[model samples]
Target: MFASITGADKELLSCITRLPSFFWEGNWAEEIHLTICPIPSLQDGNDLTVTRDNTGCRIEYRLPVHLFRGLGLLKEHAEEKNFFINQKMYIPEIGIMTDVSRNSVPSPEFLQSLLDRMALMGLNCLILYMEDVYEIEGEPRFGYMRGGYTREQLRSIDDYAAGYGIRIVASIQVLGHMEKVLRFPEYAGLRDSSSCLLAGSEETEQFICKMLSSIGSCLRSRQIIVGMDETHGLGEGRYRVLNGRRPPIEIYLEHLNRVHALAGRYGLNIAFYSDMLFKYGSEKHTYLDPHMQLDEKTKELIPSDAQLIYWDYYSREASLLNDMLACHRSIGPTVYAGPLLSVSSFCVQYEATWKTAGPALMAVKRQKIPMVYGCLWHDDGAECSDWLGLPGMQYYAEHAYTEGVVDPGSLDSRFLACTGLDAGWFRDAALLDEIPCINPENRWPPNPCKYILWQDPLEGLYDADIRGLSLDLHYRRTAQLLRRDLEEAGENGAFLRVPLALAEVLEIKSALSGALSWHYREHDMTALQQDAAALSELYVRVKKLRRLHREQWMSSCSPFGWSRLDLRYGGLLARLETASDRLQDYLEGRLSELPELAVPRYTLDRCGDLLGNGIWKVYDKSVSLSDG
Candidate 1:
């Protein structure tokens, strides 16, 4: 179409032409006159309108460079569907947070690519949740050995994000979750406990000021997320030793007031989680509980300007959400609800995420909240890859824009068009956990594939739970199915390699489990030889899987955190070799018996839940190895 565009509207045209599907119809020879004008009262000045005429089309986009890009995506969507969207996003802020604190510090280049994808999805903001993953002046050992981003690197990322109409908000801990910073001798005095900063301490306030000063220098966004979430024993630690036996709420308010003052000095708006406020006041002590009450005294302590973020990823009840929203509104005018992508689990729970976030979004829309965002957290080691959370991100974006019910078919199409991957296949890969036949209740917190794969082979503690299932056959079939999907995936298959390799590793490991069980049960000579041979062959597959995993890790993330994967796979390989050698020696009659293999069968409470709050703990009691 022949289009005349001016101002920031020209940037929108540039972005449209860059779309991979833009050239599908050859050159645009159609006579189409397009003009994108700015609207004054657009939602947060982000409203968009597209009207078409016989001569051409006119798009009235909002001001600010970022809104231009957002409206650009809407125009592209409307053009593709052959229908104009006279819609304004109800929620003005749509953003995402990357949990760099949990591990996996994404490189600046990778983050830029992510921002490109976010623009296509119509996301307007990005938050880097860096507890200590960014360099602060005078803090040499702060992010030491963890590959934190330099000041220049963060500034470049901010500038790039601004081009796409995305604001890069800085999220840092002011009161708690300072484990990395507290480890150094210099910061040890700032500790309230291991992961929290001492409340009502001058040294702690000075440290927070330094953090704010350093972060304000690098980032361009005016909004700062001062993390005051999950300070379990806030005033019970070093604060008690210094400022004897005070109620946590008083101490918390004192610390928050100091931090809020510091943030104000830098001319920044502050936002923090509302968990601690309700947690200290309520009997239930939970975020989503509707019955939890916040006393007026504690409410009075909250800073009038500070925005309270109510984050919930597990609640499905709309009534409970409405109640939580009401509770937050009582506290402040600037309140945001944070739904989740469910990436904290070792695998993405697509259904759970949709079920929870859908109702949560609808509730927020009903209340007409000013801002809402989805979080992709890597809590506790960030074992799952970020790519796995795309489906959930897409789900949040589609729902955030439209007030009406979304069409499932159109959503899938848009996901494929924007991401170049099948939404069905992406969500289905999470089903790999089903092969282990774990109790449905226990499937969460930890993806069984990850837990089982990393379990010590010599111990095999979780093995008894899967005794009845044909694990070898199931895992092998699952691996083959994933391989077929990968082959059909074409260029997009590169992202599939990590999961595919994990499935392949599970197949060999499952087979090995069966072999080991047989040797333990029946001490026949022929069976021992067969088991030894199988272990030798499977050891090769383990090595191959390790190499594949390392390749994918290095390609997708920085080198700073690959050691976790290296140690995991490296330990698995060493154990595999040890098992193979022991079996071979016994087969050759060098030993009288494989005493470790000869274990008496005992029943395990398989029906009970195995995952304890998503963290894996090794069994306390040791398994004895007889030297027969």
Candidate 2:
């Protein structure tokens, strides 16, 4: 539809021209005039005032994001000639941390799209969580064969983020979670323990210096999130051999000081995940432990400048979150990092995300925390897209804009205000993992889709846990719903197709083990042959899912880490064909029995600790226990 837009500068006009593709639906019968007055503000994020007058629609906004929000409001309320919208974003600093360190490094465009959406939502910042996912000069192996961004690439992304008044924060590993880079023979000396660098080592210090230099030069942001969160065996490895078992607290605090010195040299404010401090203090070494306490000495030693982020994505209770927030505050200036619940799964954990985010955000508001971020981590090889986390981010905004209880009605309307589509669209897409779950919320963050899809049809690692669940029907219906949504969703909602494809694959994949084991145990030859025939179709579906996954990955990411998922898809494809052939052989009487199914199945969940580190291991090993 033709519309005359005024009061928009070149950049505003550019974003407005792109708006139709992003959020526009049915064309207007007549031309619509939109006048945007985007003003600069000293505020952390933008606030907007949208009004409809007899002449046309006008938006008075402090930043590009607020203009976008104003545009969305104006467009949504096109019918209302007389209206006024004075929207307030409560949290001083609202941002999203995307885990690009995983297999996918999202394209600048992908990030820009997110920036556009965040702009509409009045969200202010973007954190690039790169554990060696950005190139460091003099260190080629750092993020080697991973989708690491070049300096120019990062600058482009940061520039686009700036247009929307979004401040981008750099999240790089200063001490731990450098296994990807550390695994290279060149960096072996820097390694102390699993995924951690040698504490107090001059060599490690020099390497970290390079990291600080790289981010400082590459991105415009002065804020850096130094990752030293889960250095579980910090002093137990090479550090012990060198330092002779100094107290972990002393070692950790010293490392923080060293990192602080490096960060200051680069003119950057530093932050680290506070889980380690709490873990070290708690007897059980658990994060979010209410009893977790840091001694005064340790607290005093912690750098006054270091912004400690209390990261939690698991807790569901307000009391627990409040207690934990209070505990962290006692230590130092704290930032709360909650989640979209995308960690360690093929799909978004909607139920768990909502349950945790709702209480966690409420607690942050209650505590009047200034800075909060919704972290979208790509665990288990970046199986899901970062695009899927939009709903959860909007949920954070909901909590931010509300002074009293977040209105239930405003949930959909406010979410729709950010993006034209209903919030239910993203929530529905996340149901790919919610089927096999027994509880109302998928609390343990069960990724039945990942484990079940990759688990052997006969071996069935989690078969005991899902023995009686009708996952086939659940996935089938879920697939149907997604397919419907995919058809209806225009270009703006094209991401729905990925989850739809995933659900379609899961419909058949989730049921294969149940069918295989049951048929083999019952000695049903005819049923086994039918299963063999189905594998042929499943194989085709698997190939399509992989292709779709690859296309989605490539469109938004650098091509480096794709080979990792490529190998996985290759393995999955090969196994599907092998599974069919093996079933055919068994049905033709070439094999005596299915030995894989014969192995006694054990329940994983009943073990009580299955949700611990095992959760990470299970997602990795469910495909195969060992490399062939």
Candidate 3:
């Protein structure tokens, strides 16, 4: 297929030509020509129109993304073989922030694919949230052995993003969320808490300078997000010994201003998560405090140009989101961040994600906020492929691009045209967590598949909570559905394979414990034999899933930190074998009954409805319960 691009520079033309072949497959024209002519009447860089005839398709767009959007329309209406489109974009910065810090930094090739997809959806920004996964000069301990990207690598990615009119913003930690950096002996002097840096320390000041200099030297975008959210025990550790029992607000503001000053040295615009501010301001010490008050001194201390970002991933009401938006705007220049709910366990929580993002996006638009991005935060392991967020990204784009309300039909057509997959298939993957659906909107995002797949079958922690849920049927059906979709998944089969493999494991495992407990108490030899056979089948299935997961990890992420998941899968496989042996002994009457069966099962004792978000982890993800 011959392709000709006009109104785009040689660089951009090269970038577009290199896009995956499927991007242009729908064009039936023998000589496909795309011309991005400027339309003075159109909104600057936000409005575009495409017209097609026998000669070629002329797309008049002010911005590169708008041009791609025009091309997107071409493919969307390809079956018509002739069409015209005029679209005016709503939000200027429809972007995504992918967590590179949480043990899953995307490979450059995958990053390029990410850029290609974002551009197709007319997105104009990508924020890489690198807590310690980015190269910093003279800071060997910063991202050492963490698969951090080199300076050249960042520059290359930024250049690629620029071709599609997308900016690459650097999201790194300057205050808290630095456990990876501060854990080393070399950087211990800067530590105040386990994850936070010492406030008002001379050494910490110098470290901020190095961070700014190193990061600013690489990323093309002037915007930088220095995470200052959740600086728990802010003044309690070494900071208290030095600064003496000062308020968290004092320590946080002082350190943030210092970071703001250092950022200015590199001409970098700074933004930080604003939760700590609200947490400190209100008597309740929570972000949702409607009565949240910042003292005059606190308000005066805020940097005029700095942006305070409000991030929410678990709200369904637009009114609640609007109130939070109001609270954030009262403090300072505000940016909004919502979630794709692709964190923790092994799947995207679409019910939580879809419900929350809709209201959040509506609230942002209602306030006429120009910039908003969806956060794909891999808080625990990032094992759930962030690639699954494609549907969420498309949902975000359609909401931002369409004025007022989004047309569902348009969303489906555009997403299919942009990604070459039905949006429904990815939404179906959410069934991995949606089974045994309890609370409304899956607000807690019960990720039972994660715990079920790893928990020892003999000593199932959640066995009582799952007794009546019929989860085995749910998982079996989910696996059956995804297996069919995997055949049509094409090159993107890896993404579908991950959830499909998980569902296959969960189908057997969800019910295995009930069967084991039943047979052991009854001492039925016939059922004991069946249990042994089931465990044997489970061991093979688990091994296959582990191998598939490893491939999924290697294909998209950095090589480092994979051992964490590998070791976890290894332990599960080992436990499965042990369970099989114990069952064999019980069948032979060597052991009277499995000891675990004699012990009465109990519901999640203290945690109740929210027991680790349905994921079993030794280190609880709470400030009080947190070990890691």
The TM-scores, one per candidate, come to: 0.88, 0.92, 0.94
The better candidate by lDDT, 1 or 2, is 2
In candidate 1, which residue ranges exceed 4 Å CA deviation? 1-35, 41-46, 51-54, 63-82, 334-346, 405-410, 434-446, 471-474, 524-534, 593-605, 608-628
**Evaluated with TM-score, which candidate comes out highest?**
3
Kindly report which residue pairs in candidate 2 clash with one another: 107-556
What lDDT tens digits, residue by residue, belong to model 2 across residues 1-628?
A: 3378778678756656665354665664145777767656523444677877777777787666667666666656766778887766666788888999877888888888788888777788899888877878877777777767899988888887777768888988878787887788888898887688998889988888888998898778898989888878789998898779887878999999999998899998898898888888899978879888777777889998788898887888888999988988888888999978787777777777777787888888888888999989887688888888887777776677665556433567767656777677777887877764444433467777778777766567777666667778988998888877777776666778778877888777767766677778788878877778778888888888888888888888888788888888887788777777777877887987767766777776434322222244345678666666
lDDT score at residue 366, model 3, on the 0-100 scale: 81
List pairs with backbone clashes in candidate 1.
66-165
Query: How large is the C-alpha RMSD of every model relative to the true structure?
Result: 4.1, 3.2, 2.9
TM-score of 1: 0.88
Best by lDDT: 3
| Predictions in order: lDDT | 0.69, 0.77, 0.79
Worst 10 residues of 2 by lDDT: 606-615
Q: What tens-digit string does per-residue lDDT give for candidate 1 at 1-628?
A: 3345444345556654444443223334234455566677655434666666554555665634334444444434544534455556766787777787776888887787677667767678888899998887887988898888999999999987776678999899998889988988888888889999887778877878888887899988989999899988888888888878987878888888888998999888899988888887778776666567667777787888889888887677789889989888877865564545445344576655666778888888888887777787876456667777776666666766788655444677667645657887675567556444445443233355655576556556556654556766766776787788888887667767767777777776665554576665676777767767776776677677678767766776778877876776677778778877877777777867765567654424256433223334322211222232
Cα deviation in Å at residue 106, candidate 3?
Answer: 0.9
Least lDDT summed over 10 consecutive residues: which range in candidate 1?
Answer: 617-626
